[model samples]
Target: MDDPKNARRSDSLDLAYNAALTKLDVATCEAMAVSQAIDVENSELHLGFSVQIFKKLCSHSVALICAVPRSRWVKSEFENWDFACAAGQSRAIIEGFLLFLYLSQTPSCNAEWTAKLLVLYVNDCTRRAKMMANVKAVDAAEDWMRQAEELKDRLKLNPWFLNLDGKTQKRCLAGDHLMISSRDEILELAGWEKAEFYAIWDLLSQYAHVLPMSFTRMEPDGRGSGAANEADADYLTATIAWCADTLHAATNRMTAGFPSTETVRQGLDSKFEPGPKENRP
Candidate 1:
């Protein structure tokens, strides 16, 4: 028989995990509804881009939601869970949420938005060029690079882009994303503290990158089976919490963009807050 104390812990974790999952589901639904309702063709460029970003975030949320049950099944059937894989997916969700917040929101100046779009276009071209070059498609790569150069020239011509410092201007021309604001500033816009978010991000990064920290502190279970146990539960709960928080934030931003969704958004009462070092043992 399970100890009474352990049973209580299990019950509590189940409740918390379920609650977080529900919040993620509701938020994602809200995002999807908003995405479908928006007329991207008629919207301004910034608004259209925002819709696209929000749609991507919604897709990430859906994948995470699906992974939760799959992880549970793996733990029960195979007696093992892929925590590292989930960590990487959670990191992607975090990044998508942050980026959606950054690009979807109205900028102080329209020109800034235009400049951002141009840089993104240039980055896309540069990435495609590199991919083609990797496949030894020299002519295709050169064509992509030429298009990127044209974008760089256009970006340089923008008054807002030219107003940036010389170093920033150079970075923009080189296709650096996130140059619109410092990392901390972008997090602040999403109501996240830089230190706290970075701490969790660093922890997730360790697993995502398969770093030594991810495996150095492996404590064996009493049964000598390193399968499903409290440690895995903790990691899974923390991942759920992170997904809930990020999707919640994204939902709020989406509602702001499409006020009609606010009613449905407010109906989601369950919310999760992730601390700076959540799940870090």
Candidate 2:
């Protein structure tokens, strides 16, 4: 016999999961519409560059959504609910959402946007240089480091970058973040409560980084193998909830530059809200 509480939880999970998938489906279609509506030639050069990055992120997001679930057993199982795998992918989606939101916003001026782009380029080059150096590719590492220096110099020349404090300039040069806003501020801008978001993010990070929570929480079934059970279901539910909310948020931001997307964005506000205050019954 099953516990009534457990059964109710399962039913709720089903409803939530279905709702999430529906939201993602709608978001995906609307995102494509926004992509199609982008008039690059007529748009500001900064917007053109930003939209290209936004389009690529959306493409990757579509792939992540499709890859989230799959059948693993022919006999009885209909899906693989590996909690670690699911959490890892969900973290990727969350991180991608941060970048997507950053790029989707319109800057005060082209110089401001250019400064942001330069920060990103410097970060990329720095990471590449480090990666090459780790593998003993001296010449490649030196080339990448040189490029990073050049980008940093150009960033310094930007009026917007020049206005930044010394600490922030150093942080940008070190490839820490592209925006002047702190990470917490960015999350708050996206409608997440600071502590609540970190709680969920930390839980996902444990699984993503393969901490003790990964194996310590597993249980053995009578068949001498671990099985997807309640906990896996919980992780999957969280993933779907977060991803669905992220997709909707990204689409909303897309509407800022692509005005045509506003029509589709309508009626979507009531769909998926991750923040505590905005959650609907």
lDDT of 2 by residue, 1-281 (tens): 99999889879876766676566656655565566656777876656766775666556555545544431101234445566655766777787777766765678987888888899898889899999999999999999999999998898899988898999888998876666667787887788888988888888898789788777756665111235466676666667677767866766666776676566443333222221122222
Query: Could you tell me the lDDT of residue 228 within candidate 1?
Result: 52
Candidate 2 deviation (Cα RMSD)? 6.8
Quote each prediction's TM-score: 0.81, 0.81
**Candidate 1 TM-score over all chains jointly:** 0.81
State the lDDT at 252 in candidate 2. 66
